[model samples]
Target chain A: MNKLSRVLGVVRNQLATYVPRINATTQAAVAPTADPKVPAPAKDKHEGLMEFFDVKENWTTNEVRVGRSWRKEELRIKSNQDLHKLWYVLLKERNMLLTMQHEMNEKWEPFQSPERIDKVHESMVNLEEVVRERNRAYYLLETGETGERPGRVETNKVGMHYFFKASEHVVPPEHNNHWFKKFGCNRREVAKFRLYYNEKIWLGRLKEKNRNTRHVMKLYKRFPDLDEEALQAEYPDVNLERVKRWNGAQGHFMPRNL
Target chain B: MSTRWYPIYQRGNPQLRVFLPNFWMKLVRPEHKQPENIVRFITPTQMSDHDIKQYLEKIYKVEVASVKSKIKEGLIKRQRFRGYIIKEPDYREAMITLPPGQTFKFPDISTEKEKRDDDEIKKFQDAASQSFDKFKEMNKDRPGVPGWFSV
Candidate 1:
């Protein structure tokens, strides 16, 4: 509680220092904070409505500069509403970058520093996680349970069992035969797979064994005084002491004085 | 991570909606001649036929009569030094038939007729301005040399 208050205080101080210096012209455009009892100042209804893939701005510029993601600590101090606004901002940035990247590919022009798009994406994902954390906290405070996402387990299309996470659906499982058939899998194919899968595993093991043997041979071939203790620790499966006494671990070019 | 997984539904469910769907669909021109209502897409390999239906219906606001997807094997080549065969990942192409009346044609982005003329004009103007700037900067240092001489 004390830490939360301290963080909140720091954020309050930063808000006082920064918000006042913001351009006065821009201040009037943003809606002012009202009573908590009254619902959030009705946001522009068009705000979050599928603006990401809008086809308006196609050909504009070559290079784009973007800022770093908001850090966890920085986001933790923010109110839920501000965080939501920031999410939209990041979302818009991502959409713009993606559109530009798609256009660049279509134009066959080299996308300059494509990692900028990825960075924006990463930032958006992090911001989402931070918001989810705060939402969970708020729900816990209000309703006494973490409103974190839920998950479940189910079989795959191949009869292979896997976790099918719990999520809401447009149609209930009882009614949705399409979904039920979708979840079911081919069991005979899975059996045929298991046989080949074991063979592949055995082949991998054999290759791994050869690799280890060759590695040990190469190690001792180079070094006359290979540390046995260290070698044992490194290759616990191989009998290092026995391998050292064997002729395979010996150098061919020169006789060791030791 | 999957698009096909439809979960169990209950009353007053929060609309099992995805806030930010990571699915990407590229609107590509069809190769062969097709009906005006049909559109083609080179979508992600992981995208199912159902996903294509949902993407068009929900995002594009286009009614899809049917969606058929096929995986086209990528080009294969012999590696330069290793002498080993390398095959690229198979990309899925979805051919979706729109209900009716809707026609999508790839816009001609580059105006080919004016391109060469515009380039030639721009080049000549740039050359002229550069020469003018050089002429202006030339007469600053030399005593008797012409204005075009070394500055």
Candidate 2:
């Protein structure tokens, strides 16, 4: 057992040496050191509680200028661990901004540059999307599945289809009596309701089609030399030739054919 | 749990880890006077006492002795202009107690702001008086002439 443990340790050390140090390079690239010629700004002491508020100078300022949010492409190049660290940094910043805004609201003062909240939120959303993309790609490559929460299109009692997100359950469908009883639907009633619902939808579509045809006819009547190809392209669903045959489509002066 | 979804916990299963926890907690001033060691926070309603404790201890690196939390119901009132009922969003309030000897005092920022405002007002008044004096000096040559007539 001792010999086996020693060999395993040797293997671990070898593997560690073989792995490239990606984190160090990424960190250096992310935050470059300030130039030696230019004096660095004074660093604030870590006042644990006061971290919730903005700097004292900005407390009274009317506007605080800040750069735009982190774009998706910029975040896409970052490693997972770097992204994780960034997420916390952004989260802390968001909390601080929120705290400042809340205090300002209470004191009847305008919160300077409220768009900063939106910027942080946008960065967070982009970061999450990038992480999800990576996770999806990894899952697809390894498991041959999307790895997202499984969901299915299910018809409700009202006969309307909705996406039902599947949740983990210890009990199987056959054993879950309570769920089956609660979700049971009346087939006959649903069928009758569905007929009316479908007809209503169809009627709405028909009205929209008629409105488009009438609109096209008005256009033809207004512009005698209207570009027929452009009009056809604009309203692909509407039959322009049939609408042109209508009397309302004729111009006041003279027919173009004559 | 706030932003990212986690798998359900089952017996004998591996522990669920949250890679991206989106829970946010904002430090708020206590409405009533509280002990120096206690800090107030406004958090999402979904956050529990344990979550608040873990959040402060793990993320903020603050030593927490105990945590107490309560959900404040939103106020429902009639809109003055529209005469419609509107409800404010409900939020969870957390009171975190630090270990002995650790104390935090809320900073007073309003006094500094008031001083700056006073300076601003004085500057504006001085500028206004100077502009008025110049206008009067220009109009002294021609009496009873409108200011816009010269321009």
Candidate 3:
């Protein structure tokens, strides 16, 4: 209790010292308005709906210089409340930039610094990623789950597999007759399609392997003195000895001593 | 984020709250003349009239009397050579009415820019004319000669 009272006393003394400073700052702000010789502040007192547009000075300029987007590392250090506020600030900036671009397009004028939109978009993406990372960490610590939307790889009627994102529903899958009727695909035709699709995929892989092997042989033929280790590293899947033995791998010059 | 996937709402569940709503609202010029107090905005299709009202009131601090919105169909055009049809994405437009005494005017942002461009064009034209005059003076003695024949 003694320590608590002492801490409270220190906070009270600090507040007493800070109160006059805050008052002085407010007084300084008001002093400018009282002086007739001094020019009014550059920023308007209230922007209202005009906040949708860029500053008046920028309207006529062909370039509006701006810094790069917020990095994920920078956003990670900020607290959740700061991130929340920054999200709105970025949102408002994106909206303003879009508005300016749209209006400029309508007026047949060039929108300056179009990359600003991309920068803001990149910042928003990084910010969201950081938020998601924190959320995932929190959920994992609390519930052993990522707390992200659930999805699964499911084969469609066309035998094409896709990630199906699951959403909340009033009824379970067994009770949802309509969903089952739409998504259920056990027909013989689908089975045949899947078979053909698998064959095509396998053929594609085979063709790609053959192409790589041929390319390696051509490289060997062109540059017999090429570093074997580099070639092997480039095409790890190709059998270097088998490719070296192929006729295509031979050059017009005499074979070098092994 | 505005494009983040959300779970479907079911009755008797806790109210869903968007702590960091990222929906964007662009103030657009009205297609037709509107009342002084009416402002037009293009927002995401997912936003309803109530959402538009609350967005302006809460985020922009604008007092909205009412809001009416409609989904505008995008234009469909065919490729010039290939003739493949392309349809632009549809957008939602909201017409917000401010309080009776309040009004907003969409300022003309291009006038100053147009004037500056005109000055630049004039300068370019003057420079081009002066250069042509100089070239003519240089080639006065050799009429009908090609410009490439010059040293």
Number of the top-ranking candidate, with lDDT as the measure:
3
Q: In order, what DockQ does each candidate have?
A: 0.09, 0.29, 0.32
Put the candidates in TM-score order, highest first. Answer: 2, 3, 1
* Model 3, runs deviating above 4 Å: A1-47, A207-258, B1-5, B78-86, B118-151
Better model by DockQ: candidate 1 vs candidate 2: 2
For candidate 1, write residues B1-151 as lDDT tens digits.
1123445667777667654455666656578998766667766798899887886666434678899999888879999998999998677889987656545554433333235447778999999999978776765565467654443
* Candidate 1 chain A, run of 10 with poorest lDDT: A17-26
Error of 1 at A158 (Å): 8.5
Q: Which candidate model has the greater lDDT, 2 or 3?
A: 3
Interface RMSD for each of the candidates: 9.3, 4.0, 3.7
Q: Sort all candidates by lDDT, best to worst.
A: 3, 2, 1
| lDDT for each residue of candidate 1 in A1-258, tens digit (9 for 90 to 100) | 233334434654664311111222233435665778868633322221223333322323233344454566777777776655555445444544555456456666655557766665676666677766766777789989766556667656654457766776677877998877876456788878877878898999888877887788779878867787888788767766666677777787655455
Q: Please, what are the lDDT tens digits per residue for candidate 2 over residues A1-258?
A: 123234434533543311111112122334545789876432222245565777777767778777677788877877886677667767777888899888888887778899889988998999899999988888889999878888899988788999998887778878888988898778999899999999999999999989999999999888877898898888888998898889999878754568
CA RMSD for every model? 11.7, 10.7, 9.9
Off by over 4 Å in 2: A1-46, A210-258, B1-3, B128-151
Model 3 lDDT per residue over B36-112, tens place: 88889999898998888888887767788899999998889999999999998889999988887777888789998
Whole-model lDDT per candidate: 0.60, 0.77, 0.78
How well does candidate 2 score on lDDT at residue A192?
95
